[model samples]
Target: MRYAICFTPTPSDPLSQVAANWLGRNVFSGEMVEPPAIRGIGIHEIAFHTAVPRRYGFHGVLKAPFHLAPDVSETQLLRDMMRFSGSFQPFRIPRIEVARLHNYFSLVPSVPCEYMHYLASAVVQHFDRFRAPLSEAEIERSDPDGLSAAQFANLHRWGNPYVMDEFRFHMPVTGPVNLVDMPRIEQALRNVFEPVLAEPVTVANIALMIEEGTGGPFRVHSLHPMGKVSARKIA
Candidate 1:
């Protein structure tokens, strides 16, 4: 199994519900969710665009997936996650909006927040001891030649190409979109997400997600609220 540390909105948060609907799966429950109707877009088209991200569910990556180091145990990792999450206090992002990152759509902060970067970097560095070195196949899959110098270096050292200085907090909402369909997709996104984005988003909880098999769906393992001493595992 591979483990990832990510930021998932609380189960009750409106954005969580929006994402669950958009992505066709609920990370919290591992249950299928029906996609919302998008004007000018058929249900099959929506499903096609969401296929890639649906497997990972709804989350903003703090640490990309990694196998446990030879000596590490899941219990130990969970304990450390509780301690790490508890050490920091929660903060809020002023606003977030749907934006295109390459060919995909993701929700990103309207302005950068240093606190989120700091937290992401901390997660990468702190739990790195628990990450096993990437396998040869893994390195090939990352397309090292396509990465910039910094990204390549990070890929080798951190096992994730986008870490530390390269981190950008984004909750992916769709896979690739055709250039011709971009405007319509953007409209649909705005229609579904505008209300939830009207207010500041609190960065209050971090979750541990697990993939039980290679190329399998990721499921929420537990949630750790920032500045709190406890963790709640989902059944």
Candidate 2:
């Protein structure tokens, strides 16, 4: 099974709840809740269904898609990731209501937060063992965002080109927006996710997501809460 560690927000985390509702069962076909995507709901649903996996919907991706390496043992990788993650204090991100990325709609942090950066960096830093080098097909899926020669070279080295400086934190709401429907879709998203937008984003856990099949609407495999640390007394 292909797997990745992610930050899956819970219902108590309103933003996540709303995003979840918006995506519903349209994202997946397993134990996940929400109804299936049926025709005539909207154009976005039709198009989204065409490109999306049955188990995918909602939440931001802290870690890009990576497969567990056959040669690398999973037990060792989790232990190393936990050890590496032990030092950081649990922190929160500012509220993110609405934002746009290229042709897609997204939820973005209202302000920059160290937790976001640290989390992203951690994924890049230690989870290196799980990821396979990005293939041409993966890059092709990116299309216009397709890697240049420099990016292709970086993929060989980093397994994902959008690491470090290239990383931009945003939770995608759609594939690419059609200008004519932009306003209607935006409002629909706003209405569906309003409760989440009104609150601050609490960062307490990291989720492990998996893809059981070739096509995905990926869903949570497991979750690891970032435990709070008591401040060490100075010697």
Candidate 3:
């Protein structure tokens, strides 16, 4: 199994519900949700667009996934996460916009925030001790040769190349999309998510997620709040 630290919205949050329906899966509950109907896009097309994000659920990654080191235990990681959460306070993103990330689409901040970068960097550095070193096969899968010098160095040092200066906070909404499908997909997302995106969104908690096996759906393992006072623990 591998573990990842992610920023998942609270279960009761409207954004969470919208995201769940859009992706057709609830990461918190590990259950499927029916996708919203779109005039031009078929349910099959919606499912196709969502396939990749559905496996990981609806969240922006903080620390990318890694296997636990042989010496570490899940309990140790959880305890450390609790302590880490107590030291940080929540912040808000003033606005989010739908944008293309390579061939995929995601909700990203209209402007980047230093606090978001700091929070993500802290998570990557703080819990890195628990991460097992990448095996040759794992490194190969990452396609290190395709990475830039800095990214390659980061992958070797931190086990993930997307942290620190490279991190862009985004909640992915679709897999690689064909050029012809982009318009309809974007329209469908805007129709359902416009109202929620009009307001500021809070960055309140960090979710611990687990992938039971390779290519498996990641499920929410636990949630830790980002302020002095922790909320009721959830499994």
Backbone collisions counted per model: 0, 11, 0
Winning model by lDDT: 1
What would the TM-scores of all predictions be?
Answer: 0.95, 0.79, 0.95
Q: Rank the candidates by lDDT, best first.
A: 1, 3, 2
Q: What is the C-alpha RMSD of each candidate to the true structure, in Å?
A: 3.0, 4.7, 2.5
* List of clashing residue pairs for candidate 1: none
Provide the overall lDDT of each model, using Cα atoms, as 2-decimal numbers: 0.91, 0.62, 0.89
Q: 2 or 3, which is superior by TM-score?
A: 3
Model 3 has a clash total of 0
Residue 145, candidate 2: C-alpha displacement in angstroms: 8.5
Off by over 4 Å in 2: 26-54, 139-145, 148-153, 228-235
Q: Alpha-carbon error at 18 in model 1, in Å?
A: 1.0
Off by over 4 Å in 1: 228-235
